[model samples]
Target: MAFHAHPDDEALATGGTLARLAAEGHRVVIVVATDGVVRDAPGAALRARLDELRASAAVLGASRVEHLGYADSGHGAELYPDPPGRTRFVRADPREATARLAEIIRAEQASILLSYDVNGGYRHRDHLRVHEVGRLAAQQTGVRLLEATLPRELTVRAYTALEWTGLVSGHNRQALQHGFTPRAEITHRLDVRGYARQKRDALAAHGSQLRKGRVAPLVRLLIRLPAPVFGLALGREYFIEPGAARTGKPSRQIIPPAGQG
Candidate 1:
């Protein structure tokens, strides 16, 4: 199960991984935590975007798509005063959200659960709530794999070095400026280079939110980067497994390139 805050998030963050898993015959499900109404897109426009999401899921080979029916909590200042009749995700009861997600996990019999990091990858309030609900649902369901982004020490080091050398530019700088957490704590890195094209196509399917002119080139560039470079130094997806037995020492679940098998 891939838990995302909104429609486009699954494409942005886990498209590659999800596509690869589905291609390998793994049953994959996407749980969208919100309706993504923050952008002020018309009701019909949002529904169209969701239909696009479903189409993208098909391209990604997802077996199912689940909507938690939560509302998008607009970014930062926009969240204040709770927009008229719109549902506010930040103020939604976490317990209720967790219960909803937990039910989905049970229904799907999800062995693995993937979600954004605690920082929401960019500190979006809805993203943070997804993280919290994911953690709680994982605990409740005893899912064997809980995939999430963690702050990666090496990524931080690389960013710092780049900043010192004045090489950080474009989107990298924008990421820094916006306080996005791109360097996550990686635990498992699946080599998605084989499915990179499918991932790109899946991303493209989110037409309403991802305008082709704006994101296509960047997606192309990202797909072209060597797989090793793509995962940064971690070169593996990361996760924190709940209820796993601890041996009084950290486990070496972090997959190196040679260990991707």
Candidate 2:
């Protein structure tokens, strides 16, 4: 199962891996911690985001999809007020959140849970919460945990390329500097080049993010790239095991063999 902060996150961070796994006959489940709604933000509706997430998940071949029932805290300072009855994910009780996720882990019988790195890949409040809740829930359920991330240097290079094409207009150049895990710390680097087209399709499914500046120009540029260029740039996915076993050159599988474990 892959657990993420938002709708497009699965497509951007682990889409290829999820697609590859499902194509390989493994049951892939996509779960999000938030509905990714901010009432004041343009084109950011809860139902729209959830629909987009389901569409994206379908493209990635996820057999099932779920939300943990929380509101998007959004990025930057000044958290928005929670919608009607829901609480902002960042303000929810950790133990309660952990329990909710733990229940899913048990129900799914997942062998491993994929989530964000310790810094939540950019320190977004909701992503940070996902990292924490995922780790705790996986532990509670006796499942392995793989924290999805990019080598800090890779993110920097990506931002630079995006900047050159003006695709990252108004985006911070140094945003990738601090939050990602380092290359040396990454335990798995799965090559998903063969599934690049599917990955691209999955990303394209989240049309709201692409239309609104919510995700901005970076994704816009990505979907526009030719197949080969997109594959070369984003065909590989990264992850860290966080104290889990490591043996025999970081196996390519997201869920390593039982012997390896």
Candidate 3:
């Protein structure tokens, strides 16, 4: 099971891994914490985005997709008002969210729970909340937790270069510099170059988000890259599993052997 802060996050962070696992005949499930709606988008727009998410999940071969029934918590200094009765993911009670996720983990009998690192990738409020809730859920269900992250140094360098091009916002570049797990802390690096096409398709599915200016340019550029270039650039996904036994090389697969745990 992969738990993410928003609809597109699964695609951006772990889509390749998910697709590879699914193609290998493992049941893959995606659990998103928010509806990805901000600024009180029209009901039709919200529904359309959800539909796109479902399509993305299907293309990635996910067996199931679930939303944790929370609204998107917008970024930057000002917080957007919640849509009607819906609560922003960042404001929702952590315990409640943990319980909700734990129930799903138990039901799926999931052996692994993929979540965000301590800094929650780029430190979006919802992403940080995902880390908090995900850790609790993993503990509650006794599932092995793998925190999805990139090498902080690498991310900082990439963001710095992009920032110079005016592609990354000042706030976002700063966030990226501080987010992601340190290289020494990363325990796994899955080579997912083989699944680049699926990852691209999954990313393309989040049409609504790709239309938004804040993150659209980068997403569009990635999606438009040549398949080989995209694979070379985003082929490996980094992860950290605290207290996990590392007897051998970093795992290329998400799950460990059944008896090893």
Candidate that scores best on TM-score: 3
lDDT of 1 at 245: 48
1 or 3, greater by lDDT: 3
Give the candidates in order of lDDT, highest first: 3, 2, 1
lDDT of 2 by residue, 1-261 (tens): 999988889999999999888887778999898888755534437778889899888888898999999888988678878777788899999889889888888998998799899989978889999999998898788888999998898788877776677666436656678878988788898999999998998999988888786456778878988867889989999999999566656657676433444
TM-score of each: 0.73, 0.91, 0.94
lDDT: the better of candidates 2 and 3: 3
lDDT for model 2? 0.85
Candidate 2: residue 216 lDDT (0-100): 63
Give candidate 1 misplaced runs (Cα > 4 Å): 80-86, 150-185, 212-261
lDDT of 3 by residue, 117-161 (tens): 999898889999999998999878889999999999999888778
Predictions: Cα RMSD each: 5.6, 2.7, 2.2
Deviation (Å) of 239 in candidate 2: 0.3
